[model samples]
Target: MHRHFQGLALLAVAAALAILAPVFCAERPAAAGAAPSPDSQSAAPVVIQVDAAHPTGPYSPAWNYFGADEPNYVYSKNGEKLLRELAALSPAPVHVRLHNLLTTGDGAASLKWGSTNAYREDADGNPVYDWTITDRIFDAMLDAGVQPLVEVGFMPEALSTHPEPYRHDFPKGDIFTGWSYPPKDYAKWAALVTAWATHLRDRYGVESLNGWLWEVWNEPDINYWHGTPEEYDRLYDVTAQAIRSVLPNALIGGPDSTGPGTGRAAEFLEQFLEHCLRGKNSATGGTGAPLNFISFHPKGSPTEVDGHVRMGIQRQLAAMDRGMKIVASFPEYKHTPIILGESDPEGCGACSVATNPSDVYRNGPLYGVSVAEAEARTYELARKNGVVLKGSVTWALEFEDQPYFAGFRDLATNGVDKPVLNVFRMLGMLTGEWLPTTSSGGLPLDDILNSGVTRAPDVNAIATRSEHEVDVFVWNYHDDDVQVPPANVHLNVDGLRQGRVRVEQFRMDSDHSNSYRAWLDMGSPAAPTPEQQAQLERAGKLETLGTPQNLKIAGGRLPLTFDLPRQGVELVRISWR
Candidate 1:
């Protein structure tokens, strides 16, 4: 550590970080439901090296998969604004997914719930398809240069076995009684799906629809599905056939089981794949279903301990590790694309800080850094498992008209961007092959999932090199909210063409690109004044940490050092003349 960093300025920064410790580490009453406090420590400086010339693989734009529960929210004022902002993040195709596209009701968006009355049958039992609301949802995405990862949906009223008890009011009531039931008639269900696909293909063009992935349903192995294992297999068979009838060679896969932990979800994931591989098709009476890709959900577990948030990032990563291992072990599906349909810090996106105190991190930089940590682990697991980790859809998007920093796992609260949203902006800026990177303080992937970063912060970074740019992303992450010492990073970048360079640093932390902080300073306004609103709007965007700096690289090596606060993420971009 002395060899990597030894300077008075560094010591001063370290001391200042110590002085500001209580801001992040102070204890609050358990009932106050505040964000967890990280244990205070004298952070050791981490030495990381980025080998730009040794490109490993393309930094696949797999991070663009975004979703939410409310389908109609796509066209809402806040939703439209957020969607367009998301589209602008990456040139790589952004695939949007949503729920309740086929449920029965007037289009109304709510927490943990949404509905679009897309299908109905008349008194004569004749099928009637209303593409109105669903089309609007699709149109909003398409118009913004975004596409869909079509989540072909919850049972519609006309076809559900028990449609009367719809509109789940979970965490508040038990109306989720019927939406989980299987279709009353398999034939009607198949026809409804066929018509839905045909409409999308016709309206959006077959070529465009072909580019999108058509997943059979959301998580069918949990409360999301009230059917038995064999019954879900049957549903998948018919749904796949129905979709393929219109969209030729349609991409489909599922079971979308909850994380492959040692329980019912894990068992269901294994059994579902077996059924897809060997069981007779319930629709065609042929062995195997048309499975192009496999999907599942892996969510983190955050528990309130001593009135602080101790995130279960390891639990989520372990689940993904086991899940990928299961898929890779199967010789036939070893190389198939894997989409973890719902990847989040935890389940229950609708549960806010209002009820769940552990979620207090949603308002600050913790959400951003946690996502960065998970993404790094996700890629590591993919390489270890040897499968095409296609996309891990972020299960939360925007909730329009909510109070500022409402503490849902959302990209934004009530239209203003959250710190988590800018993390993607930092990721979107990288476009090249991944450079070999090693960090002294980074935790090993296996060790992280097995235990978590309890003893020290996982100070890590990822490097990418393009023809004209070298991008480095760093984050300070730990499972517990204890305020660890600032990760003073001394990044030694190698393999650069020795010459003059320009370096720009962007940040997402309490004081930058974080509207939640700005809102809190303004008295946690339920409704901000016009000037406050304007202030938050500007605060919501991705902002630079400081002015760009000029430097020179001699003999293809350069070293840059910066301090990263707890739960903060930083990206340094270098370009040469």
Candidate 2:
């Protein structure tokens, strides 16, 4: 069958599975209920079945995208190291999105703040352009072999209508400063963008620069953009036009609004799409502006409940659902690629546990499993909605000079990788076409959408098939942070041509591939010695379960069983030998 047709069929099967009478309908296995404790073993096994004969559509590496609000960190010592790590995770070039590229400042960085001073006026009120800081930022990305999802935003201080208070102190005070406002002159704004694009094209040939992604601004439905909807749309038009003028084939899109689960955000997204399809172009007098892709942010709501953190996975998924539904409603742009500009456990990446205790999940396997589950379900949601999801940016990066395991929503703290980063590494291992898989312990999509995983742990698996191997990515996740028993997973794979296969498994839990737990075991050091730091770095990387196992296949089926702890993620690779 054609790959596209096969993917549609697979989606139809998934839709049917969502409405099954009994949610856990994969094979005959005992019920895998809530565990007794974090250390206890599971009594019942959750059976997961993977059919490798059928090939779905080609897999898209959506999890490779990452971003941060602090643009200056791109060149910091730790930031550059983290960028290299991110680039090496996958064969595909990672795309990074950043904020405050045009904001005026001295090229300093802090929590939720960064600047390039790319634009400033001369003594006689003429436009002055400086690409030094911006070049350093892009140069770092290129040096690391990553693409830039350039966010053309945060009005320059010289052009902002309200430029007195250009920067803000975040996590302590308001962040909607003067730079968030619209430009005082649209023509000047366009000129600034044009100059920036021209410089990028000149420095790095047009062919190299054309591969970069571009977007107007971030979260216009919220404080990130201080303007009316029409005004923001106009700004997008001008910015898009300016970039294309330098490189006509640039990939650009906009409105990067907040989550659409709320009414106002949904309306904003819908109006923006409608305007893109029909509204007059403010830059060209054309019928509509150029929209190469759609962008939005979907964040969860995690709160400290009863002294433990309870994640709001449903909230984040709902936003994705609503946003895709809106896009699918418009035939003119339904097939356009959609990028989740900032998909995370919650907003406020810079907020630490000292202020927001619920963010403690950032340090352990909870964040890892949460991300695995979210990315897995997103593939299902995209199939159901018949829309293409290009990428989902994990709005996190390294925070320089921070405490070890400080509860900030970041991929790394003080140059040490977190457990969540290993999850991305595991995801990066998955390639080729998707294979149909179902888990007995997984709740239906509607059930998860309605009540989350609070009732029972969500033990699920998504599998893929390549020419040489088949990979199954499994996760045991729960919304509540309470300790639970490990789940016994019986993964059955069919349609392998060989009589035997070599199995390799990678895990991220409290005991493996987790730097936070390692640090805690070391008495939670304030500053680790160089030797300890090396040990922590080793522990932070993805670790396998001992050596690879050679398992025999019976009746064209491979049965592999393992114990997966709650808030844990595992990637099982079966290689043909």
Candidate 3:
């Protein structure tokens, strides 16, 4: 979830810097590590080789997680629809995270803000607890077949150290208000958290919460917490104790700091790990704290250059590289699960293309292809660093009462789906063990780490094989958002059962599975007719390129050829008789 913060200069040492969140500006300036535009030229046909007999490891759905900033949108008409879609996309469990769950408000949601009025105090320094709004949000999630990554967050009004200006008008004024401060009374804060957890247990049963994840606060290394590092540690210790006291088996961990590429954020993460490992716990006077998982956020730094958007894939990857290395440095917690709490192309999902033109990629196939490439590379990074990646939360969801295709960084606009969500639908189809795959035209991981895919397009594929089926996901991605010639792709599969095979292909591009373009072809209507809405709904679904074909496998090998457009994503599924 995006939260506006006060701007501070971040120094980049050795190609590592903190990618700042969105600011209110006409055009965002290019950062130091932003990828330069690549030459527009056609290249060779890529060859992707997949061996179904050899399995590298088990395939984990690390990209199945998603989140947003507005918590009150959980039950909105559009929000509920989108949640059901997300839950249906994956056979595995889908988890949703949100911000402002504990903020003080009257159950309203807006840009970069949400509230449940979960806690407040009455006269004579007494405690008053309310769980009506919170229960509503959780119930909506459970009803939709999704789990909540409960983000214990932003201070309640009565408990804040500076409660005069609890809520601030975002995008027009200072967002780091009193809600960003620490609690004035630690005991009251602990009791509030304990009561909240107890109520949830009593209402939903203990088994339900054992499967969910609980974390304390967001990005405290920045303005998300106005307190010092020690104070944040104290808050986490107390909060973890409160939750554990109620549900001892709940999966809980925290200090979800910003990207550790910057020196300050990296230092904060290291300090927190030290505190959890050896420092005294303020809650129980124990020697160490309970930490089941570690979390951080890594965002790109896209900017408009030469009247087009250029992605900062290297910037985001650099942050992940630094963070994973940090987690691996400690032998005591080297194998703990690590989650990229808010992974995205850039920060500030609430910022639209109208003001910041760099975000124009959100409404097109670029967003989908970019996510595909980023996730594939992240899995590679985790393997390189020898860490178990829990998941990378895509911080985009549906926004209500918005114009169609307004270019907000979201999976859907109003009620219709965007091209990016189709990528997840494709990812959901992948199951079983990962097959050994290699691409001739793919860029080396080190090369992309040093410089992004600026010299050539990354034409790669991730393939998996089940008992009777094989799935291959391919993408043609470039950092610059400009039209170029399509790449010819040759997909080869080996070790398949020798018999008749049914081959099917699904695609997401400009002409297929894109609702934004469909809306534009309908003359960009403010309020579309019923016919147009139905047409767009059909266009939004994942569509196959052509009818499924039955082909004969000769000597257990099959070769297929196709042309993949720039910024296009495709999935191929083959089943043998």
Candidate 4:
């Protein structure tokens, strides 16, 4: 086995051990509230019906849901180490995206190449292409069992109409330099993609390359693309044709604009879709476009209000709903897979500077809970819209060699798993099949909407079951703030045959695989002592809450009750013989 695979296996073992350790063995305060007695009248089970009849997808595992963006900083030694470390956690497949690969030039004028920064100009102004940097990045992901949600973006410098002032004017101390601008030439852009696609087919084989989803530019409606919608359409046409020229079976598609149903994004998506269906390609003069998938970017807000973090979950969901509706309007796009590319709590992946206000949430549980909540909601929206939502690419991953707590939006800090990653680990265990379930007395849908439940709504539950196993994931989270009132939950599971079902539970809260508080205990990672390091080692653990219990089934119902803290997530798996 490859060394990375071996390393990943070891990390998995460690995580499993941490999750299976005796709950009482860990040093911690007794849970503030007691587990409700089964016979207690007030603790009566809130019976939720499980519809075993209505099922979707063969309960087989859906894609492993995760998010990633290009980490230009990973070019440094420390950044590479951090990426490898994060790769070990949840070795399940991840969706990796290239945010600024099409950027070129320098200072206030550099441009990125999106998926691969392949085109560079020599001193003689000739186009020079390099794949070594991206090859290493993709290799690392492949070794980790990750899949690339290939984002074909920013016009390569040699292809951009405006190429000289290529890069963004990033503030001082910003590590993301030279990777965020439009390409320099269009023909060169097509050639670069064609070459890159052929290279992937050569290096990883055509079969492997076929599985990757090719997305066009990122947030063309926003700062990512300065071109007008018509120009972007032309760019898309040429790029799609180019990609197909090499890999005819390549899954190519994207408008990748920001929030396709609102503001400028909605306008951009509508125009792109219309053009794909009706607008004649100047080159081909045909209505049929190579649109295999539809993609758009949706981001939540990360504003600090009233001394607590506020996430814009509603805004994102609304965007998703609109995007889906727009796609469904066209018969041609009805079956095309929709991707929520670059879905996150906020925009600005490289906003680590002090001037960028959104960087505040990057280092704590705020980011973790926000990511979990946002993803879960995205899934819900997709089901509601009845659209085939394929991937919600998290615009975050490890930045290779930044400081221990450099404030970059990442899944880990200095090789430690963040709370956000714990959610993915929990998700990885739930791949096989989705079962039917019902919840008694959840916050009404309208109540959730009217009250802006994105802040602090109500208890939410989702369940999935297989032949012998049933998994129930429950959460007690509110939208706007972290300080939530304690709530008691009575989970009543029906439809289980009378038998002992072994139960395993995993949880995320103020503790357990949480690096935010660990950083705090370590004095903010600014100054670290030996003891602090030890504390960090202990703190970055996913603690087992309790031992797996073999519960007796009675009267075709099983009852379990526990007090869930605010912003907490719980996973329960019950398997019967």
Model 4 over residues 168-208: C-alpha lDDT tens digits?
A: 34333322322334455566667787888888889999888
Indicate whether candidate 1 or candidate 4 has the larger TM-score. Answer: 1
- lDDT by residue (1-577, candidate 2, tens digit) is 0000010111232222111100122232332466335544375688898888886768778888999889989899889999999999988889999999999999979878899988999998899999899999999999988999999977999898888777888665667899899999999999999999988998999889877999998888877777999999899989998998889999998778988999989999999998899999999899788898998888787654544667889998988999999999999987799999888878778876556544566888888889998998888788879898999999889787777777788888888899999999999988888888888787778777777767677888888888889999999988877766789999898888757789999999888999888887787789899999998999899999999998887788888889988888999999984
TM-scores for candidates 1 onward, in order: 0.92, 0.93, 0.93, 0.82
> How large is the C-alpha RMSD of every model relative to the true structure?
8.3, 8.1, 6.6, 9.2
Task: Write one digit per residue (lDDT tens) for candidate 1, span 479-511.
Answer: 766555576788898998978999999999767
For residue 225, what is the lDDT in candidate 3?
95
Name the TM-score of candidate 2.
0.93
Provide the lDDT at 261 for model 4: 44
Scored against the true structure, residue 335 in model 4 reaches a CA lDDT of 80
Clash-forming residue pairs, model 1:
37-481, 37-482, 38-481, 38-482, 38-483, 39-482, 39-483
Alpha-carbon runs more than 4 Å astray in model 1: 1-43
**Candidate number that wins on TM-score, 1 or 3:** 3
> Which ranking of candidates, highest lDDT first?
3, 2, 1, 4
Worst 10 contiguous positions by lDDT, candidate 2: 1-10
How many residue pairs clash in each candidate at the backbone level? Answer: 7, 0, 0, 48
lDDT of candidate model 1 versus the reference: 0.79
